[model samples]
Target: MYPILFSFGSIHFYSYGLMIAIGILVAYYLAEKKIKANGIDPKRLEWLVFSILAGGFAGSKILYWITRIPDIGTDPTIFTNLGDGWVVYGGIIGGLVAGWFYCQNHGMNFWKTFDMVIPEVALAQGFGRIGCFLAGCCYGVETHAWYAVVFPEESLAPAGISLFPSQLVMSAYDFGLYFFLEWFSKKKKFNGEVGAAYLIAYSFGRFVIEFFRGDMIRGVVNGLSTSQYIAIATFIAGIAIIVIGRKRFSQSNK
Candidate 1:
């Protein structure tokens, strides 16, 4: 793993940040094309994307801090370590809230916009997980299985430990989800169906991936990680949304 892609004397180029930037760029390109094709206003989409990024970053950092609160109580200085650690669930929640508010204020269709955007989010996340792999964060538990990866001294994961390639697995899953959602979009019966499916798909994948994750930075509850609980809730919510959307669609037609 290579955290610092390169250093120019006093300056350092981090792999994590670089990959995240790349991901965003790629995702934006895809979204922009989609917006134009769908006849959506580009300016409003740009503003909505900005809101999502800002809110997501804040929420991710806040959740990371929340997870570390117990440890912070024992050693408050632990809070100083802020170069890494983010929760995707929190970011999703925050982005949704921010985007929803923006849509409401702008008189935009929230569900329609959400459906268009969520696939791009998944695409970006796939690249972001590659960043995680390169940075050695969100590593997997020790395993004698054939697909184990060994982190070097420079990596964030414990050096030389043979571990599962959880990051790559999650990355693959994200990409797969992106493609599946893209295809499913065309056949979806309701406006929010694609967005709801995204939640269900991502949450289920994440819940399973948590079992392979080695890092304990993400908090756990009753043997399940915080993400697993969120996954369960979101999965249920996804089903409910689909059902309600169908019901409403039928009522309107009737």
Candidate 2:
């Protein structure tokens, strides 16, 4: 795992930034390859990537700031710690909302675009999770398991004890999801089937992983992890999309 790729005197090349850049590039690469197959111009993939970048980053950072409101009153230093606020779920929400607006404004079919890009989203997550592993963030609670890692240099280590590799867990889940959804990509009945499935699968995985996350996190609702709550909502949304899409398919067929 590479937390800092290199250093030029006081400046550091961060693993998180590198991984995120590479992941987005790969996601865009795959999206460009598949765009034409979805009956759209491949060039528009550029726009979609922008939408994702704008949405994802804005969403994650904004959500992080909002969630830190309580901490602002108690911990004056919270404002100085920009790195501590980001949440993956927030990024997803932002990216989705932004991308949806971009598509609508550009007169592109939102559902079809989502169908074409969902697999790539999961693929990106796999790469991003590996970044988290290198940065030693998003890790698990303390444990003595054989796979436990003691990250002394990582800022997010759990109380100076070895903990579960929650980042690796997420990486594994993302990889599994990539292959599974790719296999079923052709079986989807409508434009957004893969998107719906991805939301459901990712939400379920995130929900389970949140249970093992040992890092300090804030509660946004009813003392539950903010991510867990978002996962539940996304999970239900995925189910609803599948149900509604299938119903539409049935009616169209009849």
Candidate 3:
């Protein structure tokens, strides 16, 4: 489905890569605006973003490799083939860890920064899902629904079969979540509320979406996809954060 966006004299630009780049830029611009409005040091934005991105990339790749461990015995290229395979959950965790460390090192308030940035992360994910759709990755199960899509021969999805279009669905969910997070942030009683809400909402959404997913490359454990397990844990973690954060806020106020 038009994976190659354009070609320039023997060089081709892929739709997936292009869309991700656009997503990063858009997210970064929005984050800058948010940081400035919140009185954060605008200069710290560059390094903070860089650290999160680097950590996210590494985490995604590492998780992908872990899932492919079974394939490694059959295909030695599984570890070296860095062109594809990444776990979104891994990226989320990794980015947060990196951001936390960066904030600690730079004397920034981690929860405050995360609350401001998490909505942008969802926005970026919305664009990234568009990339996944264009590349025909993260495809949905075959369906006879009227809204099903059919990928061409060049696409990664099974060619010419009507499918559920899960990528677009996820994209829409991400976009909607971004707006909801933004609204929640405004009404939040504590610094970590928005970020915690994000984890809960996104994890639950992902857990449900996994049922629609056709690709099983991400591994399954005990009748559930790898992400489903992670989603459960993430959801619990989110709840824990909210409880702890609210308690801390209450204590501080008293």
lDDT, candidates in the order shown: 0.91, 0.83, 0.93
Off by over 4 Å in 3: none
What ranking emerges by TM-score with the best candidate at the front?
3, 1, 2
TM-score of 3: 0.97
Clashes of each: 0, 0, 0
Q: Per-residue alpha-carbon lDDT of model 2 for 98-124, expressed as tens digits?
A: 889989988998988888788888989
Residue 230, model 3: Cα distance from true site in angstroms: 0.5
Instruction: Write one digit per residue (lDDT tens) for candidate 3, span 1-254.
Output: 77888899989888998888999999999999999998878889999999999999989988888888888899988788776788899899899999999999999999999999999999999999999999999999999999999999888899999999999999999999999999999999898899999999999999999999999988888879999999999999999999998998899999
Pairs with backbone N, CA or C atoms under 3 Å apart (clashes), candidate 2: none
Q: Choose the strongest candidate by lDDT.
A: 3
Worst 10 residues of 3 by lDDT: 77-86
Candidate 2 or 1, higher lDDT: 1
Model 1 Cα shift for residue 207 (angstroms): 0.6
The sequence of per-residue lDDT tens digits that candidate 1 reaches over residues 1-254 is 99999999989999999989998999999999888999888998899999999999878878888888888888776567667878888899989999999999999999998999899999999999999999999999999888899999999998999999999999999999999999999998889999999999998999899999989777788899888898999999999999999999899988
lDDT ranking from best to worst?
3, 1, 2
Off by over 4 Å in 2: 76-81, 220-223
TM for candidate 2 is 0.93
